[model samples]
Target: MIDLMGYADRVWTGQEDLRPYFSGALREDGLLPVADGVWMWAATGNVYVFRTAGGLLLFDTGDRHTSRALHTAVRAVTQDPLHIAVFSHGHVDHVLGMDPFDQEAAERGLPRPEVIAHRHVPRRFERYVLTAGYNSAVNGRQFRAPGLKWPTVYRQPDTLYDQQLDLREADTQVLLRHGMGETDDATMAWLPDRRILCCGDFYAWNAPNAGNPQKVQRFVAEWSQALHWMAGLGAELLLPGHGVPIAGAERIRQTLLSSAALLDHLQQSVLELMNGGLTLDEVLHRVRVPAEMLSKPYLRPTYDEPEFIVRNLWRRYGGWYDGDPAALRPAPRAELAAEVAELAGGPQALARRALLLAKDGDLRLAGHLAEFAALAAAPGSAEHAEAHQARAQVMESLAADSPSFMAKSIYGWAASQSQAASRGEEPGKEEAGWAP
Candidate 1:
């Protein structure tokens, strides 16, 4: 039942009412209510605009249109040109929009703004392009899409630092701390003056994306430690790369503590499982968020589920080869699919059972049954509607369950598809694929 979406679980049960409380913002970037006049852009990435003794500083350049909003937000407060642009560890979403700033400055006949990043950022981009195929396929699974593409061109960073750098500008005294959590080149900028900590990807609104089930190695223990250190920052306001900002000293500390505890539990649990020599299935069966931990509103498992996090812990500590010998010399997937179909008494039988499960209030399991039914559907079989409806039911319930930014996007896409089927319309052009 838990294997329907291949990895999604029933961790969201009886949690429908929690959906509407999401404070996700629509715009890419805007102002942060903390520190009085500070502004931030909360995109699929995080961007911070800082006013210092020198001039304007842009931390993380968000996706393409970010500069327009940055300009607007900055002008409303100050008329200074951007003195420096910081790269929050160069994942494309955070840096691609630097061109806009460059263009804006060029129009005024100013210098191409200084772009600062850790020395490894440029190397990461290079690796991204060089291993585009690996990234595409891994991203496909992580995002739940079958086929996705990676970026073509990559750029090197201008101002690169090797270790830590202390930022002292405008009354803001910040410590730029580095680590290997979500990314090897990750950084968390701590401002002691305002007691504000700008945690890039190390600490986001969601569960740490450390175990993305896709790209490179994720340092789980280190990620947990980084959060531990962040909790000690005496931060009154916590601004992340994604989701709403968290303000208040106690709230900030509590959020970080809970996040760190969650990771520690996951890391510690997986290590115990490994020590006990438990299989993956056995380990997954035992994964649990301690009652006290899950009770925290900020620590809810809405966006990134705990199972994936567990598997990520397994990977980080044990390496990619999950030690399944058959996987090393496996039969073709199509052949395996046919064998499984035969064993299950054909696709029709699976579809029928799926419809039954769905009728019995097991929407998650129904999705798998419906998929197999759809895949096994004979061309021109009227069973198409049956499978489609099962998928729709699962999606609708999913929407009501969490409605996190990702969930809403998927729910909306699934709804549009169902509506199309009813109206005899062609597939939606913006068919929401996975978040690769």
Candidate 2:
């Protein structure tokens, strides 16, 4: 067994939840045996293979880029054909690894593995097809990997279930239950005989990703309830999608429950502020989770920040108004910037003030002031150059301080744009997709 105490000390440094993983020795193709017959392949998204008497059962096949590596890893374990493959959700990373497995099976004169997932997966595929280029561009910026393209080819699932699915492979009983969490089509697997629960992205080592600023609306209430249900199962071994597995019944239960409590706290806190007629910005400042809960190893905000979660809750319960009349029908950004600059004397003055704000560590306010200066100043002007440089510095600082990879990606992209503008280049618009 890996030394838990030493591993924890190396992995958890109280700064970033996943910094240890990136700095550690785990390679993309490395496979770790979590149990006797179950093994996990670590990558952008993990793949868990269960070697049953009938054949191999796979849960969440990694990303498309890691397909060959995944195939090599699986072949190292067993040559038994893949009898069944289940998608944990409709995300691109979880579903695109099917082609490699299918290709290998075809070469061996074997039938393709039967794919299974929730009913909503087909719709998700349709949406991906509709917005293939758009999703590709957003993901490129999100991961800071320029020109990363999303494939138009999707392997549709053969078996689709609504809420619950039960299958018997040899003597192993596999139960698939639908839970609304990171995605609407999220599925969690439970093995009764082995007492192992494979939770997809629902339980990451970092904080819950339900509050992603760039993603769709996550079901927070249902997600919290799902955690409670998983905790009640009394599973001895818990396998998550992105991180190491947890052994021992009590440890698994507490980890799950603590994660759920964090969600519950965010949900309740957001609702309390919304019911009091506070605006989204006001509620963002007011709703706060306890430091103790935030300090939990599994509850660190390394992917989704709490503020974004509050905005999602507002979108669900309070609608799109955000309780701010100015945002209902805002003026054109350039026009507003010109007006603000005029009121502040000139664009040069605004640029100077922005630099001062950035120096004072008010990055958020500095960003706004710098944008106004940039928009108001003429192209190739000294004020325009100064404004862009200040904005770039502010964005870089924010990116460096952020623990969330998503936040760092966006802020880094913003910094790049500002830097380009300072060079007098017409920086292209940010193609980041709209969050639903």
Which candidate has the highest TM-score of all? 2
Residue 64 alpha-carbon offset, candidate 2, angstroms? 0.6
Q: How accurate is candidate 2 locally (lDDT)?
A: 0.82
Per-candidate RMSD, Å: 7.7, 3.0
**Steric overlap count per candidate:** 2, 0
Q: Write the per-residue lDDT of candidate 1 for residues 1-436, one digit (tens) a residue.
A: 1121111112223333322222333342245433455666555576778777777777787765455665665666677788787776868777776765677789989887888788888888889879887776555433445446767565456767777888666666767778778788877787787787888877665566765544567777888888888888788777777655666677678778778888888988889988898767678779887777765656666566677788888876776566577776898554554466578886556667776786677766766665555445443445545544555565566556642434544554564455454344545334433210
Clashing pairs in 2: none
Per-residue CA lDDT of candidate 2, range 1-436, in tens?
Answer: 3433344434444433455455434544356677888887776777899999989999988888788888887887689999899999989888888888899889999999999999999988988889887777777778777767777888999999999999888878999999999889989999988999999988988778887776668889999999999999999888888876777788889889999998899999888877787889899888888889878887888778877788888888888887778989999888899999999988878878887887888877877887788778777888778777877787787888887888899889888877888898765535343110
Cα deviation of 285 in candidate 2 (Å)? 1.3
Q: Which ten residues in a row have the lowest lDDT in candidate 1?
A: 1-10
On the 0 to 100 scale, the lDDT of residue 106 in model 1 is 94
